[model samples]
Target: MERTGRMETITYDCIREAAARLKGAAHRTPVMTSRTLNKQSGREIYLKCEQFQRGGAFKFRGAYNTISRMTEEEKQRGVLAYSSGNHAQGVALAARLSGVPAVICIPTDAPPVKLAATRETYGAEVLTFDRLTTDREAFGRQVAEERGLTIVPPFDHPHIIAGAGTVALELLEEVPDLDAVITPIGGGGLLSGTSIAAHGWNPKIRVFGAEPKLAADTYRSLQEGKRVSIDPPSTVADGLRATTPGVLTFPILQSHVENVVLVTEEEIEDAIRFALLRLKTVIEPSAAVALAAVRKGALPRDCRKVGVILSGGNIDPSLLAQLWEREATKI
Candidate 1:
């Protein structure tokens, strides 16, 4: 299958190169399987556990892959990026590993644990913005220009997409016969990468994107055949609250993804609880979006073997109180 008019720079070759670059830097996070997951979904479910990834999320792959390739002068100048939380931690950690400085802009209301981890744990200079009022991309660019810092976009860059593709690349290498793959979409980095890797490995494999229904920008974009910006989401999945898809990623997702699954906040919370209680693992709400889709039968019935990426586990352990206030489920 010839992929014409697709992202030119992000091929299987590029993804393979990223895998090579990430060999030692990124953890080869395990492919997890559970009888309970299989029974709930009625399919052979392979869970790509990225919660165990460096920086406690898969964003480190792209952050390191992008920042590590910078010129010596650029590394000395350092990098700038904006995120709600996970990408900031990834960039801060990667910069530390590379012996460079990183400036991260995060939302003021971002999870306290994530904010602390980005600032104190990873040792990045942190800036806060009102996510509801400020445009983060514009703010990041302004700061980068003033400080002469290199910009590391959360997504929309070829290297980021290729780096993210490595997750699916590793998964397919371990489980080549999967009938479908699902990943949560936030500006489409992970989903686009997963689509490229999954289709590249086996063109027959189905690819799906999962999103919280409250933050249904990607869903609306796919329907209207262009990017759509919604009001800021009040969804529990804070990490997935992008109002629109990336300019580059939207096209890749439009081209390759089978469909986008929109799940409710309740379903997402249920998945979080399910993972903790039954699966004996921790997953944040954003990661739980993918699981909610699978466990709730949102995929096609023909998908007998499904692969799901549990994207992160950066939720504050205390957040369990807010999520399960009435119930007595303790982490």
Candidate 2:
């Protein structure tokens, strides 16, 4: 299993080193489970609860890993990044801790909670753009050049992928016998990293991704065996709305990921509600997709031991209330 080309830097060794770096810094987020969910799915579901992570998402792992490894001059020059929400907060918090200034470009429609945390809690300079009309990468690069700031990509970078892989490493170390693992796919960072971690730990462990149908670029990319772009996704699961898979991530996903399961908007919302009611957890829509796949029987019946990454829980209160109201009427 000599991986030659693209993802050489996102190896198990890289992830291990990242885990070492993040040992005392990152929270070893709890692995949660519900008997009710297990009975309904007929599987032992271990939810890797990353909503409890710093910045309220697993993005902190990659952000810190990338920032901490920078040269003293690079850190002083600071970093620029663009993210819809979670990654912005991650970079903001990480850069603050590392004494490096961070400038984050976020969409105007990003969750208010996320934007506030990035600016107020972490003290990052915030820039806003129309998500549908503006190209975030180009804008971020231009800003970085103007300020001599290094661009901290949300998911495409090697350090980001390696850092994210540590989630799966922690999961396997605790559970040790997971038959399959599923995570939400945005730009493919978490899933690609989890693929490396799962296979590296035990090649027999299966890896899959759960995605919102409204934002199914990763789903289509896997089907066509090439990257595909979609219009800016309009979905409640805002965190999973990446238009295309990353160049680095697509190759890792193509080589390692088994398949991606697409869940409808309704399914995603239902999972969010179920988490609040049944599991006594408040998971955001992006995190709920993984649970939705299990509840909808997206995996094989024989996948008796399953691991699901509950990616985040940074929903705005107003949005949560709206979702509850909408779901209540349907019931």
Candidate 3:
């Protein structure tokens, strides 16, 4: 990848500082080695189970890091955000923890469980919009203007990226000799952070991003040497459905990430099943993309002892039921 010269400054030190901020706040999610994954991939696989992290996803790290840093006046005025689900819940929880009111703009089509969790579970005000016909960012900004709320976007902000990097920071600290790290990419924050953290630890460590083939904007963006936009994806991995890479995140990703791999919808579903039945962990479709890419041979041939971030485990009840129905039919 060519140097874009427009990278915002996020060094290993930034990630370390974020880690310091999150030390007591965020969960030090466990790192597990799956025998079945090792056997199938023919390499030792270290799975960083971020699903077990607070709010049932890694988004909590970013949300808490961002919201906790707000000024007292800003906290009093509250925060606003837009996300499909996990980030909404993360921000909602973080805001509540900081005694800051929050208003979240979510797509009406987002999973019902996520909606309920954001509103009823976390007590954040939930506003719904038509994701298909509306621009969520513009809407969020408009609302922020009207209400004087500070915006904490899903991925893109420097603090968010630094906080997300803590996932890799913890992974590398726990498993120091890993050859590479791979994680799902939505708007590039996680991958960008992962890349920086991995390379910061050991410049030789390769970093990769996984995306649904149906929602491969980052992959296309990396290939074209510029950010690319896609039509809103219809993939089951709803959380991975960003139409474009964030402008700020793209340059960091292009600088450090080795490649962005695309996985099919079938691949993602199979990964979900594999996690439940074989690995004995429940992961949502968005979280399954990294494992699916690995199973699809997305890693380098020489790479061994790879760390995979299972980004979240917030599957909607309806989707889990559908998977169960299919499993029973196969039986």
Q: Count the backbone clashes (under 3 Å) in each candidate.
A: 0, 0, 0
Writing each residue's lDDT as its tens digit, candidate 3 over 1-331 gives: 1233655688888898899999888999999888878989988899999999888999999999998888999999999999999999999999999999999999999999888999998999999999999999999999999999999999988889989999999999999999989999999889988998999999999999999999999999999999999999999999999999998789898899888889999899999999999989999999999999998887888998899999999999999989988888988
Overall local distance difference test of candidate 2: 0.93
| Candidate 2, 1-331: lDDT as tens digits | 1255644557888888999999998999999889999999989999999999999999999999999999999999999999999999999999999999999999999999999999999999999999899999999999999999999999998899989999999999999999999999999999989999999999999999999999999999889989999999998998988999999899889989888999999999889999998989898889999999999999988889999999999988898899889878988
Residue 259, model 3, lDDT: 87
List the candidate 1 regions with Cα displacement exceeding 4 Å. Answer: 1-8, 329-331
Question: TM-score for all predictions?
Answer: 0.96, 0.97, 0.97
lDDT of each: 0.92, 0.93, 0.93
Kindly indicate the candidate among 1 and 2 with the higher lDDT.
2
| TM-score of candidate 2 against the unseen true structure | 0.97
* Candidate 2 off by > 4 Å: 1-8
Give the least accurate 10-residue stretch of model 1, judged by summed lDDT: 1-10
Candidate structures ordered by lDDT, highest first: 2, 3, 1
Give, for candidate 3, the lowest lDDT window spanning 10 residues: 1-10
The CA lDDT at 251 in model 3 is 87
